[model samples]
Target: MSERVLIPRNRGFLFLDSHPAGCERLVTDMWQACPGSADMPEGDGPVALIIGSSAGYGLAATLAGLKRAGIRGIMVSFEKAPTERRTGTAGWYRTAATADIARAAGRDLVFLNGDAFSDTMKNQVADLIEQRFGGRLDYLIYSVAAPRRTDPATGTTYASVLKPIGRANRTKTLVFDGEGVPEVREVETGPAEGDDVEQTVAVMGGTDWERWIDQLVGRGLLADGFATAALSYIGSPLTAAIYRQGTIGTAKAHLEATARSLNERLGRTVGGRAVTSVNGAAVTQSSTAIPGIALYTGLLRGVLGEDLVPPVHQLAALWDQLTGAAPSDLDDEGRIRLDTWELTDDVQAAVAERWEAATTDSIADLADLAWFRSEVQRLYGFSVPGIDYAAAVATDIPWPDHTA
Candidate 1:
């Protein structure tokens, strides 16, 4: 292993590298923040298969499951490993670090890294379920967010785009590049073109999720009372045109529909339940890329200030409801809503005022751009407080070696 002082390779909100030690520290922090006894609880331990369990809500839900419910987890994800001169993806290090923490707490966490959209990966997880989990699953969380996906049957690739549905809209967006002040610029987002919506749906939709359930149920791997959730976002009206009313919205709608379909099948057969958990907007890799999201989330964070609930805590609350520790918050459409606090009228009113008041010079003051930028850095294990960037550190960190 080579030791070198490493810094962030950042371009605006996009980070190209992740710090291994920093990522480990993040995992440790989240683990400590989680509520539950560290010791694995008694009884036949619950089992979960979290697809895309590396970063964002997926990682949060993964930690919530392990620490809150004492679940033995099988996390499926795709992340690049570090090379000699370059750092691995944040999700890569996070998964490894999580495995380390889980092992220390005497929990079972098996991580399978590969293309999650592939049938090969499904077969791999299925084999593990049969061999290691006694062919039973208590929960299945799908939190995959990818730009493109290849159809396993047709050998076709579908790519998702961030665009409005019918009419293009112009909006002010916030962008952070390096240590400089965040840039506020007006940009016109175009409408989705031919096949754009369908392709986006194909990549980001519920078909893959349905396929996973179908396979598991067909194999009799789902336990009685089995429950599943796919993470989703229905943004504020400010972004409704570009997000909730856009191509991504179409995909998420499909996902929610899949949940209902699966709910029927599961309820009829194994007394299981399935639903989409509509999460609140925050600084995530996907959110930063969307044209107006950075500005919106920044203002939202600024207005909320100390009252802002981190995604992990919100997800922990979801965990509570999912396990029946509290009543499940189901909307008229029968989907769990984790964004209730974020989408309140008072909050939206404040955010809209700030949005109107924002300019290039006052953007930082009107919105929490600095905080949003820092959060993105933390996502990739950079800009974490207490980390000694001046000191040399190892970049070639190993993934936690384990097998079913």
Candidate 2:
């Protein structure tokens, strides 16, 4: 893959096919960003399974967990195509790079290429776990992100529609890159509420998570005391309606509810536990498309550093807690609001204060600009310490071979 032009503030969207060394360098930087030090855990047999194990924080959490614990396991991912309309490819390049890093670290890695939503894929995963790990797994992580899914049994596909809630929402958001913020008006001229809500739930919420867990248990493949978790997000109230209260919010609610149900069901066999991590906002490919979040994220970047814990950091912290290395930072419901650092009353209050005071005339200042750039760089495998961007990138690295 050829190197892409790097924009000053929008490096987060660079989306390069990073080389093995570059990927490992960033992984190490993020590993140090966590609190405390723990040896990589040593054990065997399906120690961990990460669904949606390809990009963004999903990939980060997997690497961090493995690095910290020194555990090895399988990764089942439904990799998505890059937004550039890359033809006939779905993130194999990334999987290959990550595999190279894992092998170098003396960690065992397995990458299964298939849809996690289908029975064929689900059964395939169960067989792999059962055969390789003695029908038991210590950890299961659900981190897939997509717009929609077609239910194999129901023959109905679930999808999402982005729109305004409550009185024609008019808001300002960051533009294409992180350079500037712009005013936007969200209009809802699409489907009706019932249709949209159902579709959103079907596409983005807990059903798939529940199905995967159920399949594992029924196949007698889950080991005792297995722990499972799914990632969720609840931004500030300003953006909550668009994120947490709209179609996506409805899906998250279902996801949270699913966690409760799964925890109950897994009580005996594996002491099944369900956790929801309300992560902070980052400059991910998906978050950049959301309305009104960029400005808030930018504001957060300025205030959060120097003892600041963003979403990715929180994810690493939470992974540590899950693996029995640290205590949890959970709320009353046992679900951790990891995003609290960015959503704190003080933090949100400060950002809201900035929002109201900001106009097209008075946009973000140098502080905000600096924060935006740093956070943006952190998103796309850059700006993190110890990574040499000048390193050569290779796209032909070998993918993990579980069969061998």
Q: What's each prediction's TM-score? A: 0.97, 0.84
Per-residue lDDT of model 1, residues 296-361, tens digit only: 998999999867777778788778877887799999999999999899999999999988888888
Off by over 4 Å in 2: 1-25, 32-39, 80-93, 165-167, 177-194, 370-393
RMSD, every candidate, angstroms: 1.3, 4.0
Model 1 bad stretches (over 4 Å): none
List, residue by residue over 20-96, the lDDT tens digit for candidate 2.
34445555555555444445445542378888877666776666666666656778777534333231122454565
Superposed by TM-score, candidate 2 places the C-alpha of residue 96 at a distance from the truth, in angstroms, of 2.9
Clashing pairs in 2: 40-68, 40-69, 40-70, 41-69, 41-70, 136-223, 225-270, 244-249, 266-272
**Looking at model 1, how many pairs of residues clash?**
0
lDDT of 1 at 76: 93
